[model samples]
Every structure is written in structure tokens, then in C-alpha cells.
Target chain A: MTTMADRTDATTTVPTEKLTLARALTLGMRTALRHDPSVLLMGEDIGRLGGVFRVTDGLQAEFGPDRVVDTPLAESGIVGTAIGLAMRGYRPVCEIQFDGFVFPAFDQITTMLAKLHARSLGRITVPVVIRIPYGGGIGAVEHHSESPEVLFAHTAGLRVVSPATPADAYTMIQEAIASPDPVIFLEPKGRYWDKAEVALTPYGTPGAGLDKARVVRPGADLTVVAYGPTVHTALRAAEVAAEEGTSLEVIDLRTISPLDHDTVVESVRGTGRCVVVHEAAVSHGVGAEVAARVTEECFFELEAPVLRVGGYHTPYPPSRLEHHYLPSVDRLLDAVDRAMAV
Target chain B: MTQPDVLDTVQLLTPEGTRVADHRYDPRVAHLDPAALRELYADMVLTRRFDTEATALQRQGELGLFTPSLGQEGAQVGSAHALAPQDYVFPAYREHGVLHVRGLDLTDVLKQFRGVDHGGWDPAEHRVHLFTLVVGAHPLHAVGYAMGVQRDGDVATGDPNRDTAVIAYFGDGATSQGDVSEALTFAAVNQAPVVFFVQNNQWAISVPTSGQTRVPLVQRGVGFGIPSVQVDGNDPLACYAVTAEALDRARNGGGPTFIEAVTYRMGAHTTSDDPLRYRDAAEVAAWRAKDPIDRLRRYLADAGELPQQFLDDLDARAEELAVHVRDTVHAMTPPPAESMFDHVYATPHSLVDAERAWFRDYESALEDGSVR
Candidate 1:
């Protein structure tokens, strides 16, 4: 049970393991808990039930009850108490069950956790990590599939990041836990089962390129920016566009708040065209920020104005209509076509 | 009409300067001698003087606003006095007496109200957190902190100095808030060492207690499986006795206790409010008759503990404190504009850093006539 602590900074020769994004997160938290005696996990039904999505499976049996707490069914209480625990020198990782249900704790997250360090003039640091399962591809009912990441990224005091692959999940969760600032860790619930080879040993420090953008595919015709669930769609679009003799590059924005604008600008400078994709509504969403920044920095290099592919400006429709609501590969390719035509 | 009375309101001293005894709590405060009682009186008087001075400062446009703790001194000071130095305090906005008892400087309280900084005090140094303006939000933090104390092996320890507890001060209106109820649930389940002290000052701005809760606020705690008691907030000795017992229970790992200090808001909610717009003059007059400072003064004078020299010296000290607060507030200056960009995040944030750099360049441009 405690053996995970000794394996954290061990040799990097550990074989890569094929694991789901959810399992990678559990392993990351397990590694953090074992490495730092001060780290603890708290959320509703996180102990015996192993969380509704089984993201925290088998943790309680391993770490016992105190370190892996099953808190009361109160979102505000979970985050509020995590702030206090952070104040008491404990790094608490809190799990808000769903993205839509996170509004109940929004005041605590935006007002207290985000602003406490600044309010106290650096005398107090709330090193709390809020893990929210976000995005809309699961075909679940309302409140289960929604993207509320933009609301948190808009807040100045929080560090917002989402992992699109199992490998990123394995490392980013630990990075969020080790951060001195409060972090909003948005796990793409849509991509929870996405499998990838994750390194079992420490690869880098917490902040070493954890927030930087990654160029997933390289080309010269156009640049397509995406994150979380949309990253996969953009890659698919690039593959389809390649068959038609159009060279499209794809970039994954891992961090949302302190956006990696440098990478996006550099890619667009070469491609001379840009398209941003996301699952959230197109109005005032992450795509808007990406489009605006691309136009600001790559204005002279762009052949066409940056276009966006995302959900329409309406509430998340029923699960039956989700296929139409979510941004798909065909829709992203259509935006790439528009950028290339201009 | 006045608020309805609860039959179980604890009272160790009456408004007419008479002392009452209860077997359960009387022993808790029986150790206090004449000197200690006079000190308690002095605390209440000085706290009231500070509130009065702050209110005047707001009127004279020296401060943006002030939340006066004029009538709830007994509730704030007595319970605050019961806390050990190791115990932490999470206070609401109107806890001037608690801040005074916790050794927070009077000028530090004015910093936030004067539109300077959010709060200038170091919470770790004083073990008292910044005042939470959002009602009912901080009790959960207090509960979480107490859970941390329990995990640190600081609870139920026979060593008195090592064992610690946390107290969260809120008001009656906060009981309706979901966060406060959740705090009670967490504290009860974790068996955390905490005391939920609700100062039922009978008004949340213009709304009365009836608007907030149907039953007494004390009964609200019992529904959450916590032992609760109501005390006369005007009686300093009763407030002290009840709070001391609760703190001892919490430190000994007996779980949380909710104490409802039934008090009044003799002044407006803040310097910006006009209480006369909603309440009758008769209601204000009735509460004034139960003035906490006058009742304590009468009890001391009756017991021959308050000599003429003591009274003269106390008045002089109160006047001296008022002068010091006024001078300190006047002398205060706003911080540099660039300092606002500091401490947003402990780690370097690229967005904030870029904005700060741009602002510095902009300020330089203005000075050098580049932008113009």
C-alpha cells in the first residue's frame, strides 16, 4: 500500500503500461498520496463506492479511510473544507462529481480558493486541487455531460488544465497536486476510457512543460487548434484532410487558463490559416479565445480569418441529440475547408 | 414587537446587576476573581469605544464603511476570551470584539473598510483568519481546519497546551445557508474539534430572525446531531461560561458544540444602513435597556470591585484608545498600484506576468510622453 511512495522518483526504466485515462488518474493520485504524507483525497462516495465513475477505484482499500475520505454529499462543504485543510498545511485534492453539478461550489472555488492567496498577501497558500469531470460525449443525461471549463478558466486566480490522453492524465494530476497555487483539474469524462501507454516512473517535474501546447500532427497548409475531447476530432480531421492533398497541422492545448499562445502563434505563422475546435458552445467559449489570440498574433500570416467549430448556442440537448450537438471530425474538416478556401 | 424568548436561555448575570448560578456552567467561570471580571468589563468598554470611533470615521468619510459591533460585545468578547492561544478563529465581518480579544490591531480592521487592502494581518501570526464577508461560507473551513487538527494528533491529548480546537463565528441568517449546514454535517461525522458560535443579533440587515428561521437558532444545531445551548448575549459571565465548556469539550474530542448567543443589533447593520427604515423606535429602546456594558458595570460597582480610581482610569483608557484609532486610520496610506499584481498565484502565472509587464511599460510610457 505504501510501496508507491518509494517508486515515485525511482529509475525511469519502468515499462510502459496500457491503461485508461481514469486508471491513470487513480495511479497519479496514488503516487501523490504515497509520495507526500500531507496529500489526501476527499469527495462524495469516493471511498467504498470508488466514485460513481470508478475513477477512484480501490484507493480506499489501499490508503485506508482518513487519507481517502468519503465526505458528506455537499459540494460546497467539500471545496470549503479543502481550503481549510490547505490552510492547515495539507494538500487536499477534491472531486466535484460532475461539471454541471459544480455550480453549487462555484462561490467557494472562484471567491475563496482562487483569491485567498492574493487576499492574504502571500501569507496563506491554498494548495487545493479540484478535479471536475467535464465535457459531453458520454450520451448520459443532463448535468452529466457538459463543458464548464471556460467559466473556471475565466477566473484569474485558478490554474485550469485538462488532460486529453492517459499519459497526460498520469502526469498532470501529480503536477496539479504539487502546485502551490489552487488548480482546477478538468478531466475529460468523454475521454476517460481512452487508452495510451503511460510511464510508471516520474518523467519530469510538475511544471516542466505541463502547461505547454503540443503539436500532435505536422503539416503546412493550415493549423487546427483543439483541446480535451476535441483534440481527437481535430487529429481525425487532419488525417481526412491529408487524403485530399491538403496539409493540415493539429495542436493540442493542454492548459486552458494560462493558454500556450506561443505554440499556436508559431504554428499559424507557418500554416498561414487557423481553425479552433471545442465541445463547448461557440459563443464566448474556448474557441473564441483561441480564435481571438490567433488573429491577434498571426494576423498578417493568416490567409483567412480564424474559424471555430463547436456546439451551438443552446443548452445541452437530450442524449439523443448529442451527436448533433457535439463537434465532430466532419464539422472540424468543414471549418478547415473554409479556412483553406479563403 | 420584540422577538419571542426561549425558555432555556442561559443567564449568569441579569440586566439589573443580579448574579444567577447554574450547577453545570457556574463552575466553569467560578475561578475568575475580581481582577479578571474587571478586565472583562474593560474589554467590553474598549470594544464599544472602538466601534463608536469606527462609525464616526465612516461618517466623516475617512472609511468606506463600518460594521459596528456595538451591542453584541458580551457575545463577541466573552466567547473570544474563552479560546486558548492555540485555538483558531474564523470570524464574520462584524466581530470587532473578537478581533480585539485575539490581539488584532484596531487599525488592521480599518484597512479593509478604508478600501486599502483586503486584510493586512498575517492569519498565521494571530491564528485568526481574515473576516469572511460571505455569510456561512467560512464555517466549513473552520470544520475542515479542525479536522486537520484532529489528524495532527492535537485533539483529546491530555496535555492542555498541545490540544487545539477551532471556532467559527457567524450570525442567525447564516443558519439557512447550505454551507453552514454542510459544515455541521462534516464536523459531526468527522468528530472534529470545533465550536459553531452563532451570534443571533436578531437582524440580517433589515430582515428579522423570524424571516430566517421558524424555530430558535439553537434548535437548528440539534437537528444536525450537535449539542446546542442558547445564552443571554448581554451577560458576559454567562457567555464566558457556556463558551468555555464548549471549548473544553471540543479540545477533549467530544465533537462540535453550537452556541447561540441571543443578542441585539442596537446600531444599524453598518454605517451605510438605516435601521429606522424597517424597525420601530420602541424595539430599539427595549434592546438598549439591556446594554451589555452598563449591566457589567453595575455588577462590578455593586460588588465594590469597581472603585472610583478604576472607573476613572478605564474611561481614560477608552478615550486614549479612541484617539489612537482615529490617528492610526488618518495616518494610513494606500499601497502602490503595482502591488495589486502580486500574490495572485504562488507560482508564476504567464498571463498575470504578461499583464504586469505591459502595465509597467504603459506607466513608463505615460511618464516619458510616449503614448501621448
Candidate 2:
């Protein structure tokens, strides 16, 4: 990377940019809005209030009220009407204000938005995008930080995507907007402010294949599959393992609906051991799915059982306890260590 | 503006073919034609027949569950019919009667409860919003859509033909939701052309209306600055007249008006719940006397619009619809298992895709490893 304030040198050509991941998201949204006429954003306090996190700052003024709508303080109203507006050919993007507040719209997403296409036998498609900032890290009060993506993943007829990097966030968001199916785009709030260089392009230009999983780090000793905020944590654990000469593999599963099994299976086959980590509770969490898939695809190749490290089956812990609740660099490497021992 | 709706509440022709006229509600012969009354009576009978049939099927294990609207038929059908072709309707889950009026097929409505589909109708094509499972949420959607329609210059605006209004139907328990109150406030302030239809069928699951509110629920409308009224929900004509006028004024730029249809729950909340635990038989019997269909049938027969043959044909027609619905439910093939992971988000997701693949594998293994 080229020289920058945060990391003066990492590579030759690419520059180490010093911008918060949240600002990158804001800029990416602004660019997407300016680039496409169909793109419109609506949510509570997202207009004049500039959103609770100010991620939507200056968007209403730039896009105007009609495009950047300040909807009534009703989550169900926001989603149900977005389905109506989507029918009218407006590419309406909705924000749930917070993760806990999204349940009111769950019926609309799981039942209406999800099944509209399948029930209509593919005649009607709901391209509406729902954005929820998820995962606990910040000291924000309860109800603001939750990982409800697992529930959405259980729903039929909906796609769930969470981006862990500013680079993926910039692209995946535009991809979500352009998708024909309803997409639940969960932003890893814990990683929102961390900086990275993001490659920007025209909105709706799908970069990562809609269903393919991405391998964040290539290794041989063990494969660690993780998503959302946990992906970064897994990568950090991989760094620790590298110092110990363990050569750990890391996969960032950006998509949750149609599993990108080819990439995941490929990585698992390369590495003899496997572990899946997530912020969602482990009991029937996304990790359970990944572990089962790895067992199915690479049973004989796996020298160890498919292990999972995740949050406890309880409410997301308080901020002071979140560090303990969340799968950390140490816990992940420990899971990796256990897998290697097997 | 401080008083109740000045319009009449019709109470004519009981089940025994007798007519009664009161000071406030003189039966509106002006609005009713011979054919209209007969059709109205037929609508009520057939919908109730369908409701009863669905409940029986649920009990027999033919369907998953049923939310019965046995007593609220008149309130739903009457108010739904009042809408112009352009006006939109937003309904709570127990709105079989309204869906029937809006021409949604029985097969589609049943698919929802059968767990075969999330919902089976397109809101845009039918000019109705989705059946909101979340209590009281649809009113906000109805009102917001009305605001949109108004912004599009589609309100009644004293030009009767050009006005468009929205009707939101929810139950008494749903009124406790903050969304319901917020919807009324927004509709009132923006003067959105919308009507709030609350079918106070009394019990919200185990909780009675008394537990929720001390005042008449209709009066709560005035607190929000929206005019309000309480009507005998079992009276078909009263429900029709009140809803029609409210929709009329809404279309004519008269902001929002709340109509509280005072009715009783003749059946349990759903197939799973036992109402006997909470309600007494005496209360159910008292309300049974004011049954909406019997009174409408009496009015029609007395007016010479309904014949004995009409009653027989109605019975045959109801049974025919029931049989047809039953066949559709049983015939519905379980949607493909992968169909579960297909529609969570509007866009394809890497995380969801991975999980779906994972579930698909485990499911396949559980069923038989050979199945793809």
C-alpha cells in the first residue's frame, strides 16, 4: 500500500487511507445516490437529524426529501410501504434505526418481502434493501447493538449480507440495492469506524459474486470461517498464529443465503482443521451451519471436528462485558489451537 | 367537532323480519336498493360460512391454525365495500371478510394461515396493503400511504370523483400499540385522507378491553384531534353508513376519522387458544342475539329481495366455497425446502448464502444423504 497517516507503508501502489469505516460508508452512499436515479433512502431521523450515528449526514440535503424520506416513527410502516414503493419501481433503501427495533418489520421482511417472489412464482420481485447496524461493541445502551441476522437467515425468500470491511461495505451496499431479491444488509457497527481503502465503482455493479464466500487469508494448518464483525477478530487470531508458525486460514462469508460452499469447501480442504466464529449465539447460530457444512464436505480430510466459537445463548452482554461475550483474538486462536491438536 | 358523528346508525329488520327505527338511526332506504340489500346479506352469509369451515378444518388438522372473524363480518365487509376502486385498504390478520370484499381468493388467504405462504395477495394490484401480523401497525402504513396519495394530488378535495382515501382496519388490542397512536397523530396533522377502522371485538387473547382502557375506545380518537364515533358493529347497515361517510370525508380532504365498531368475539381468538378460560358463556350468548347476518337476512326477506330459493342457494354456495378452499389447502405442495432461504433480504448475501448451503446439507443428510 502507498503511504498514509495510519500505516505509512504496507504495499507499493495502494495508499493506506486514514478515513473511518463509517465515513467511507457515508461517502459510498452519497456516491451511490449521485450515481443512480433509482437509489432512495428512508428511515427515522435519517433526514434532518442526520441519523443517530450521522452516517446519513448531508444525504437528505443532497438527495432532497422525496429521495431521502423521513418516514413516520413506525418500523412496520417503513418496511410495508417500501414494498409498495418498490412495486412502483422505486429502489427504496430502508434503515431499521437499530437492530432491536427491526422485529416489528420482521413479518414484512420474512413473510411479505421474502415470499412475494416465491409466492408470485418469480413474477414479482422485491428489490428493497434493509440496512441495520448490528453487533455489540460500542457503549451504546441496549437494543441498539444486536445480531439478529441469524433469524433473517432462517427465513425463506430473503438474502442476508454483512460486510466487515470498508472495501466490501462500499461495494456490497450498492450490490444489495441492485439485487432483485430483498436483501438484509447488516453493517458491523463495531468495525464501522476502523479505516481501510475501499474500491469504489458504479452502483449496482456486483463485484463479489452474489453467492460466493470470500477467503480473507489463505493458509494450511487450520481454516477459520467467520462473518460480520467476527471476521476481523478471526483475522487477528490468524496473525497471532502466523507468529507461532501455525499458518491459519481465514474466510469472510459476506453472503448468508445461498452459501458460497465452493470457496469454503476449498479452504477447508486445504487446511486440515476448521473453526467457525460469530457474534450470534452458537446454539443453532450461523456457525452451526458452517460447522455442519464443513463436516459434510470435508469429513475425512478434517483431522479435527468442526469447532465453533461464538457468543453465549443469552442476551448480548453489557458493554463492559461485551469484550468477554464477543469471540476475541485469543478465544479464536484457542479454538484454532484445539483444532490443530486434534 | 366535539360531538360524535352526526350520521345515523341503522338498526332495522331483526332476524325475525321486523323493522325498528330510532331517532338517531332511521334506516337509509335512499342508499339501499332491493338488489344491494340481497347482495349485502349474501356477502355476510358466505363469509361466515367460510370462517366456520376454516375453523373446523383447523380443528380436524387439515389446516395449521385459524384466526376467526365470525362476529366481525359486517364491520369488515361493510367498511371494505365503502372504498372506491382507487382507495387502499390495510388490514390486520383477522380480516377474511374484508379480503373477500376486495376480491382476494379464499385459496390465497388460506395459504397464509396454512403456513404455505407469508401472504398470497399483491397489495398494489388489489389496492390494499399487506395483512399486518404485528398489531396496529397497518394504520400507520395506511395513513402514510394516504399522505403519499394526497401529495400525488389524489385526495377527494371537494371534487368527489378525484378524491382518494385509505382505510386501516385493526382490532381493539392493537390500539394499545404506539404505532396506532402515532398513525392517528400523523394523519390528523397532515390532514391525510384516511379512516381508522377499529373492530373492538372485546378480547385481545386473554386480556379484555377493560384491562386496556377505561374510556370508550372511540373517544380516544378525539384526544388525537380526529373526529370519532362508536357504531353497533353487528348492524350491517350501521357499519356501512358510518364507514362510507368517514371514507367520503377522508376523500374530501377531511383528515382522519376513527370508527370504533363495538362488537363481541363469538369465537376463540385462534385455533390454539381456549376462550372459555377467560370469557363467560352468558356474554357470548347476549351478543349472539345481535348477529349481523340474521338481521341483514331479515331485512332482505322482508323487503321481498330475498326468496327461500336465495337462502337455499346461499347455503349451497357457502358449502361450495368451503369445499373448494379445503381442496386448495390440502393440494398445496409444501414449497421447496430451499425456498426457506430464498427471500430474507432483497439482495443476495454472502453470509446468508453460506448458511443456506449449510442448512441444505444438514437437511439433506437428515432426510437421506443422496437427496440434493
Candidate 3:
């Protein structure tokens, strides 16, 4: 009998039949609209304009004006009114247009949307999904490239999700739209054009639900955990480590919330060490949580302390300094060596 | 007999209570009967009682802070009572009277103030939305709701049942916000069924109305092409009449109207504020002379609507309400620390998930000093 792994991942994986992260997201959103009648796509210039990135380019023609709404240029209005629509039984997916522009909506999201469900004692479920293209890479001017996940992660009653691979992007978005709770789907603009082989089968049938994590590459030496653009860097570093006879395990944490901790713990349990990485600053970033959790879950199982390799404690640097800002192949390889030494 | 009515700025019977009336523009006030007048009085007093009790609890370290609507009672209740059962209300932080009139429990307001929760009532249940601490954001919500009402086949023609008007309540300071202007423009252009109610309570936390606006506020609403009206907000009768008329017009598919309810602030802006530091004593005294509750009581007595026993009974009822509110506030308990991690996401967060795990290690380390 052919094993499940051989039958699915390695043998079934095809490179040419792949989708870009942006295209995958577009396809996933289109599929959701086709399925759920209540699902609406609304934001500044999302209708006839098709979004600043063309992420919603053809949606208006397919779904019509009411569902694919073009709202006034007000972020707070978009989010605040989306809450009202959710109250009236519409699954509103709001687009904040840009990262810097999202601040106007912060009060509504943090003070209102995040607390709406709990304040109602779960009597009312506000299942709004706010899609914001976040993080820096395009050498864009101020505000457009901020990694503001920490501000929102601190807020209760919200779900945060980000996808690094085209496959995960395709599947996680549909899952976020179908989710019962409010979700902030942060799409990495820097990785939108990046492509990878994405299995067309439903995630559970082919992989896991959007909320769960996936071990993209398996090994036994040490675990490297990362999400978004950093996942590619981790994979590249693993290849170099393999040449040196080091077996490094790699994990792609697609969902920022409800982390697939069991997988990380299992990896650490097997390898006896771990490395956490992200594009966000190391202080209070996603890796900090991973380091803490691995330390707690597999403290005895861990031979060395859980190490984090990420952006330094500062604003996203100029393009010249981005090489230093991001966790590069050298950075990931360095972290791997450190973990093994530990 | 020395009557306070002639000299009072806070006249209970007005739209020209001094009887110096310009008949064409003067509003009608005879609609309020003995029972209606009494009900309005009870609502104002009870709301004030609720406000005082909440503030006392906050001072006793039970709440984070309190936003008192002490002097704006007549405006809140007057407009709230005028609203139809189907008409919606969007309020700013100081709408404690609106909450009381709509039957929202005092504890619901406390949830937001105490930092225990954001808001504690169903907006659909009361047609009273959560109090917006962020200025002027909710008017757009009201405008959008009105737009939704328009899309729901609930506007135009002469059908009363086909129209559902939305009422947005804000303060003088909120008038300066971009969201408020955007809301007004949308309401006007769509001819959306909405009521823009601005409670000009003399001060926006020490910055008086003069600093906020150059023109009369009601006239400012008119610039957006919305029909505007000014009311003697200290007079409950005037408030009820003006709000009722505006709501009726909007419900009849007449589009949006703006009402600037000119009123005063009887107390400091909030628990952490001191009004004496900001404004002169004479100005505060001048506003006090127009106190809505006291003037209403004088009218009630002059009209033979109240016996001596009714006064005593009301006092006892207000005190009882105050005690109940105090006890409920004191009864509030802190939520478990895990609940913070629990509600952050509808789905679990990997970062939160990981951090929660890390926190566990720190907690355990503190407990037994086993994990370094």
C-alpha cells in the first residue's frame, strides 16, 4: 500500500501547475462569493476600481455593485458600517485599502468590533473580515509598510490570519470568510506576486483547515518556524543545511491566531531545538510568542533555548537595509547553527 | 408671589414660556398632559440618580471612569421619547438618559466604563447603539444604516410604513469631525431618512462652543442641505415637540433633518475633570439657573399636577435606584486572566497560542522556580 505522504505531498506536488499568492487570494475570494450569498466585498475603491493591487479586479463584474461595494474614502466609516451590516446578517469583508490608512479605523476595530461579541455576551456574533495588505518590502513611503499586527493581536474577540504560500493563501482566505468569528486577514503585499505549487483539493482533503499549521518540510535535527515571506527564506536555509548533513524541520504557520502549537511542540520534541522567525520586529513579535510557547510546552524536550531570528527593533529599513531588516538565508542558517549548538 | 419662571433660563414650559412669543415660529407645548409630564420628570430624575450612583462607584474605585450627562437629561429624554419604536438612535458617551429611556440596564453602560467589556447591550434590542467614545464616528454608522434602510425598499412616496428614520446623537465638538460631515453629505444626497441631533451642551470638555463653531450649529447642518431646527433643550416640551416633528417628516420620506438642542452642562465633563478650573463661577451659576429638573418640578407644582406626597415618593424612588445601581457596580468581579487570551480571536492565534504557552512557563517558573 502507498503511504499517505507519498500518495499526497511528494509524488502529487507539481511545480508548473501553480498559482501566485495574489491570484490564489483572488480565486479563493471569488469561490466564497459564489458559495455564500451573504458574503459582501466592500471598501474604498473596491468596486469599479478593483482595489489598489487589483486584488478585487474582476469581482464587480461577477458579483454586481451591491455585493462588491465601492465605499467613500473613509476607513473608519467602512469598518464601523461593516459592523452595522454584520449586525443585520450580512457577512461583510472590509478592505482597509492600505496599511497606513487603517489607523482611522483602529478605534472602531479595537474599541468596537473587537468587543462587540463579548459585550453582547455572545448573544450577537459580529463576523466581519477586514482585509489589509500589510508589511514592508516595496520600498514604499511612510505608513504603507508597517507591521502593525501586535496592536491588534492585543485586542480580544478578533481572529488574525496571514498566509505565506500560494497554497495556504488560496485555502486560508476561504476559511476566514467561512469562519464564525471576526477575522483580520493580513495579506503580505511583498509576497503577493510570489508563486508556488498549490494542491487544488480542499485543505482538509489535501492538507489542514486554515486555522491549523502545516509542516512544509520535515527533518529531525531542529525546527524552523516562520510565516508570510519569511517561510521561503527558512526553506532556502534548510536546503543549504541539508548539504552540510544537517536535517532541519520547517513549519509554515499560516494562521496567526490559534497557532498549530502541537506541530511545533512535536517538531521540537523530535529535534530537541527550535528557531522562530518573522519580518516583524523581534521585540513582542510573533516569534516571541513561539519562543515562549515552545519553552513552556517542550521545556524538558528542548535541548537548547528556543531562539528567534527576525527584524531588529526599529522601523522597516530602506531597501538598502532591507537585506539586514529581513530574515535572510544567511540569517536562518545562522539561527539553525545556533539552535544546534544549544 | 415671586415666580422663578419669568427670570429662569431653564424654563419648563417653553418655546416662549415668558409669554413674549413670536407666534409664527413658536413651537406648540400643550400636548404634554399631567401623566406625560410626570413620566418625563421621572425619567430625568431617575437617570440623574443613576448617573450620580455610577460616579460614586467610580470614585470608590469600582469603575475606570464615568461620563456624566447631568444637565443634558431633558435633551436626551426629550429626543428619545419623541422617537418611534422603529426609529434608531446613535449616541455619544453622555446619553445615560437615552439608555434609561430605552430600558438598557445601568450595568450595561458600566461594562464599557469599568473596562470590563466594550458595551453590554444588544443594539437591535434597544435601537440604541453602543456609546461612541471616539467622537463623531457613529453619525456615519447612522447615515449608513439609513442608506441600508433605503436599499431595503423602505423609503420614498407617501408610505409611512415604508420609511425608517435613523437618529444620530452627537455633541458640539463632534460637529468638527470629518466623519460627521461625510455622514451629513451622504444623508443629504441620498435623501436618506435620518435625524441629525446635536446636543450643544455649552462645552466640549472646557473648549466652549465658540471655539468649535463660528456660526449657529443648527445653521451649520443647513449648509449640508439638511433641514435644520433649533430648540430650547432645557424645556422637555420643546425638545419633544421639535424631535417629534423632525422624526415624523423623515418617517414620511421627507429626508434628513438637523436639530441643535441648545443646552448646558451642570457637572464636570467626566470623573477625572474639574469644571471650575476651565470656566468662570458666574457662567456655571448662570447655567444652573436653567436646571431642567428644578424647573420641571416648579411647573408640575404650579399646574397642580403634583401633591406633597408625590415629591416625597419620587425622592425615595431616586434614592432606591441610586442604591441599586451602586450595589450592582460593587458586585462586578474581575474576569479570569485567560479570558484575555480566549477572546483575542474567533479562531486561535498561533502567536497568541505561542505566547500563551510562554506565559504558562513564566507563571510556572514563578510558582516553583523549576524552569529557568
The lDDT leader among the candidates is: 1
lDDT of each: 0.89, 0.78, 0.78
Error of 1 at B168 (Å): 0.5
True A-B contacts kept by model 3: 0.36
Candidate 1 docking: what grade? high
- Residue-level lDDT of model 1, residues B1-372, one tens digit each, is 223223489998999888887877889888999899998999999999999999999999999999999899999998988999999999999988998988988779999999899977999877999876888999999999998999899999888998998999999988889999999999989989999999999999999999999888888778777888899998889999989988998999999998999999899999999998999999988989898888888898899899989889999999999999999999889898888899998878888988899999999999999996
Segments in model 1 whose C-alpha atoms lie over 4 Å from true places: A1-12, A203-207, B1-7
lDDT of 3 by residue, B249-304 (tens): 78877888888888988888999999988899898788777777777777777778
Candidate with more favorable, higher TM-score: 1 or 2 = 1
DockQ of each: 0.85, 0.21, 0.28
lDDT of 1 by residue, A106-220 (tens): 9999989999999998999999999999988888989988988889999988999988899889988988888888999999998999999987766333333456989989999
Global lDDT for candidate 1? 0.89
> Order the candidates by TM-score, highest first — what do you get?
1, 3, 2
lDDT of 2 by residue, B74-104 (tens): 8888777777888888888888888888888
